[model samples]
Target chain A: MISDITLGQFFPGFSPIHKLDPRTKIILTTLFIIEVFLADTPLLLALMLLTTVIMIGVSRISFAVVLRGIKPIFFIIIFTAFFNIFMTKGQGEPLVHFKIITIYKEGIIRAVFMGLRVIILILGTSILLTYTTSPISLTDGLEILFKPLKKIGIPVHLFSMMMTIALRFIPTLIEETEKIMNAQKSRGADFSQGGLIKRVKALIPILVPLLVSSFKRAEELATAMEARCYRGDKNRTKLVKLTYKPLDFLWFAMAVLLFGGIIALRILPGHISPDSLIYDILFYKV
Target chain B: MKEIIKTKDLCFSYFEYSDNDNVNQAKIDVHALVDINLTVNEGEYLAILGHNGSGKSTLAKLLNLILTPQRGNIFIDGQDITKPDLTEDELFDVRRKVGMVFQNPDNQLVATIVEEDVAFGPENLGLPREEIRRRVNFALNTVGMSEYSGHAPHKLSGGQKQRVAIAGVLAMKPKVIIFDESTAMLDPRGRKEVVDIMEKLNREESITIINITHYMEEAARADRVIVINDGKLIMDGTAKEVFSHVDELHSIGLESPQGRELINELNKAGLNIDTDALNEDECTEAILNKLKAI
Candidate 1:
């Protein structure tokens, strides 16, 4: 029952990228996202895609797993593509000869490009961020990054403390829900066979007990914390201090170069014609 | 002797609601614990004996400051628990010193991974990562759960989960670990597993243990047995002294161990036997010796 949901969700590895500091990973991911946003042309977007593919290769995770991560966003991709293709009005030559629905070269180009960009963005970030770093280390990185927020009286320490607890409890609560479901099922509460309203009514049995247990758990956790002399912001020290290494510097350099290349391409005074052979073959056909 | 915990005129009243939703209207205060005075000597292994609703759990909660006395004072390491001067932090400090392990091992465990759950208390203390690691290892080793450190708590048997829960409390480095019928939910094998860990912790680590249980056999293993009936401290003494008063125990809706009953039957059936046979092995040996004598 407790094993159903995945939390932390990290694939353990000894790879160089996986071994990098979580703060470094977080920074590099942000850098990659900036580069993705700056990517306006096919060439620059291909570079971003190449980096993500290389990341997936280096992490040694199966391609199927990476693709599985994209499954949830498939609908969003389709929705945006459909909306952009049909709704975008362009003054350029109409490509499709249909009644009241004219597909322009510009609209078709805009839709495919927008769809590809969103898909790539989601895939790249998922591989770099959530699928790799453990939640504990992620929180460690966040706490360190937001340490400066303490100066502005933001209580960054408490913020991280809350994050750690929340992350720690997600799996716990999921496990509890599974247990409660099983217990209710044991008592002959059939959750599967019902209409929408009946199904929701059946869920009340699960939800109420889950809520009660979670609160009880929170109370117990608080008591346990108190027993350990835990105060939110006090004399606390971390065992692992996030240290940026030479590899991190190399990553930063690569990111800057990528961003520089994108800007160089975008700012240049040359606009390629809509009939660029590669753009049509790669995106328009789909 | 340093009195680790003391309560005077302690009483607890839980409400019985006719309707679960209407807490305000149909609430009747059902007295859980009555006026009681008890002292826990430092480093003592005390087992509390009572049937359900006999106030054993109420007493355990009161000692840990999880449930403050409604009509009395509770002292932990000599500090009054309900003092106005005691901040929430101080109360936490008191709780840390006195950790509690509840009945359901599943409910008590809050983390998916065993090691992470064990480290929860130390992490809450905001200890250095190294220190928390050290405590987790120490606690796991104390409960003989070091080998299962990486295992999932849910994958564990009922007994193993209870051990994990104990390890979690142990990581807090609490001076007094209270088991509030912690083993009641487990099978016999699981109960023995938890009791063995408790035995080792009390014997070797000098961690005081207060086990509240309905099982009189468990009380047989404690250094002292305290019987609570309807919230009153009816009896307090060594295992033999308490268990010998079988009639008194039976009067309070409790029973001596099953082996005790077997011995009484054997003795009544024209066999010379010891009624003080507190454990199965001892009772078995006594019966075999009597058989040889005949």
Candidate 2:
């Protein structure tokens, strides 16, 4: 059953984070992700972690949720750490120098910081955007944000329109797929009892009908759209306006201030990027 | 009575490859409708009676301008649909006057949320945000779906989905609505809910309703009925005038409604009963009158 998929899941609540406008959340989430990677020093990474903790508190989402968003692609984080620990060669005190593979102190620090960077990025995004904002609002926010692309002949409304239709039909198509599968299974088609190849072969019965039904649905939807006088033009108006209220401005301001604080740290008289900072803290002889 | 929808000598045929949905299947020329000259007055409820492949749906689509007639023109609110120079915006204006509620509820609705789906038509009309909201609210309340405005479409039952679809079309404030067998896919309760809504719209709101269906009982309830068989309009009259010819209806693969059958049978048996009785109470009254006279 594909029903258990909690991807792009929004936890409905009345918390401050949930109350923020979706556009504000999307912009700030983008800023937070950029800051997560730009946070070079261990102290900056610590600050990003602190911001994540505070936002999570405001969001009212549990710690399990923050981890759950990263659970699927967590291997990528581990792989990045491994890559940094093994390949990040620098003249520093060896943390683990077994034979020719000299794992330096700088490598260990960078690897740890890189892992933290990924976890912080994933947590901040999932919490602020996907967890707090509903998918429909999120889509509206994206369409509004990308409205400028229309000037470049990108057909911005068309893309967002497609996204909206896709999001609307996902559950419908899934339900139809399940019905088709059940119909096929009732006819003595064994899906679970087959080997890999045979299982794939058994899926043809379900897939063909599902495809046919989806195409039929697509046609009907097109007719419905046409009947409603959908002009497929830029002059069309929306029901819900993406208005930035006082709460949105407040959230936007906080994100800017946090971003400014990180930039100030980077441009400080003796400050360096995180990669260099890690090198100095680990390998630079005092 | 001003005609809200008029189709003059309308003819339409579906090619095997005309629509992409039927691609890769066996292809044959399907003559859906032929030479259908019908006029629907404003605020009147007209039912198109037919079995499957009987061209009633083809007529419904032509009325809404969803499928243009291949041989004739449809006039909606006095706009000719077959105008050679008709702009796309003008076509939309025609569709605006003649809205349609299709058979499958899941297929007709485009939005995930119920209110958003209801607001779809107004939004497409380029109305202001507040106006769209107002229409959405009003339409949902009319259909008794106000409680489910925030609910997802896929989560709703067949009846609720059909109601939402109706609200979506009703939000456009169309003068006429064509139900293309809208209740065909619903259960008995869902079918009753849709019929009640159709009756309400026709009686209270004074909107023109063209319901296409094979169900004889529903057709009996309409103000007027037109029977289409083999792409030809064979019979057209009020329910009393029409159901009196039960043999002709049965000849075209349609049975008279239960009450119509009882009254027609009694008349055939030489009992002096009115064959115009459409419901159980009326049929019983006719029988009682005949027995009292005896």
Candidate 3:
């Protein structure tokens, strides 16, 4: 049951997005996130949504899979929307009044905008980053991006090495956890039929063994690594080098255009205001 | 033959901390290896046999420089490695010359992808990108894991994962490879697969092999066998010479191969059988010859 997690999931493909350099994808994902928050007007939000949809299409990942990635955050999206619709006071007439609760046109608009922002953020990062780039390349790109931090006494390479080892061992540890859980269950341990506190208490039997075995694995792994001539990142070379290609530059330019468009929309005159006719129609202004 | 590895009066000990809460408790020094003099020639297929806690693994680690000897000296390619003044670069050079494949396949693999893990050693050596790629390819092909190069290691079976670990060590192009009970965790088929690779590497590639195992059948296949017991080297000889001391081995909690045991049993039953047979086929032929004479 624990193996069903989609964390750091990568769908192998020969699409253009996958072909882009991991560093480019990482930077673009950050830029896309910023654009998601900068989108205040309905037109801007629609543009962000369209771009995310286009990216998902280009990645060739099934739309259902992308939606499944958002499933874990479904409750968060709903809670955020509900909280905004109830608590947000707006300079407009009430849409509905029930007892002490009054909902406004502006409150509903803000809730829709916030909900779309969260959804677009998840979909956009998942398509460009996790879905397209493998975990190895992702960590490699992060290491390179954070290489400057090393000058400030930050152990960037060490962090990346730790991340790589952690990723490699996650499945192994998960399988071990399942085995331990089953062994305990065979001994008549009840984990599923317990209250919150009782369930946590039941996990102690599994956690103790898992922790002990992990320490053993760590010691053995250190010995094996030292035997292989690993001496930290000093003078170490990489088999796969990340080089910026023409496609990377093209994506960079596209990102610049998107950020520029968002800033332009924010600073421009009254031609496309947030309370325009499109916003009224989209938000079902009452 | 050139001696690739040599040890002189090597001694190592682990300090076991007592569980007592006394502030002035003395740390007990448990000797793992003591006064071991051994030499390994280039391109030799030697097996080190010992039961658990017999200090065989400590000897392997000493050769690989994973653990320094508390007292004596180790020479790799005729360079004394136990010197206090040995530089880090020199230490790395020695390690590159002597690679090690561990017992647990899961802990040895550092990369998620098979090809990347194979390239780990070469990458640590700071080789050029093209050279690293070449070595990774060659190593994977050597281990017959070329098709699984792109696959995740966790998806592989135990034997396949162990093979990948071997490929990871082979990528460094070491002159000597140490199997520190590498097959102990494997099933019968997995054990055979790893033992086959060891033989292939020793015979075809001329790489020196030092396999540390408790399986007598595996030791019977080696050119030389050394027995360690309680932190001391007890017996060192050819496979036939070592297995002939069946009574002595039994006293130390070790058993001879099945063939030797059967020959001994037949001799005790008032039938003369050649005790020289170390494997089943040879013992079978000897028994058939005695039967035909009757």
Ranking by DockQ: 3, 2, 1
**Local error of candidate 2 at A18, Å?**
1.2
Better of 1 and 3 by TM-score: 3
Residue-level lDDT of model 2, residues A160-249, one tens digit each, is 788889988888888887888888878878888858999999888888888888899899989989988887753577887778889988
lDDT string for model 1 (B1-294, tens) is: 899988777788888777667646787788888888888988899999988778788788777677777788788889888676778767777878898888877666655578878877777677789888899899899888999988867678889989998998998889899998988899999999999988898989888999888887898989899998887899999988888887788788888878877877777787868557788888788888888978
Task: Find the candidate with the highest TM-score and give its number.
Answer: 3
Winner by lDDT = 3
Give candidate 3 misplaced runs (Cα > 4 Å). Answer: A97-99, A270-286, B18-26
DockQ-based CAPRI category assigned to the predicted complex of candidate 1: acceptable
Worst 10-residue lDDT window for candidate 3 chain A reads A277-286
lDDT of 1: 0.80
What C-alpha lDDT values do all the predictions have? 0.80, 0.85, 0.92
Is 2 or 3 the stronger prediction by DockQ?
3
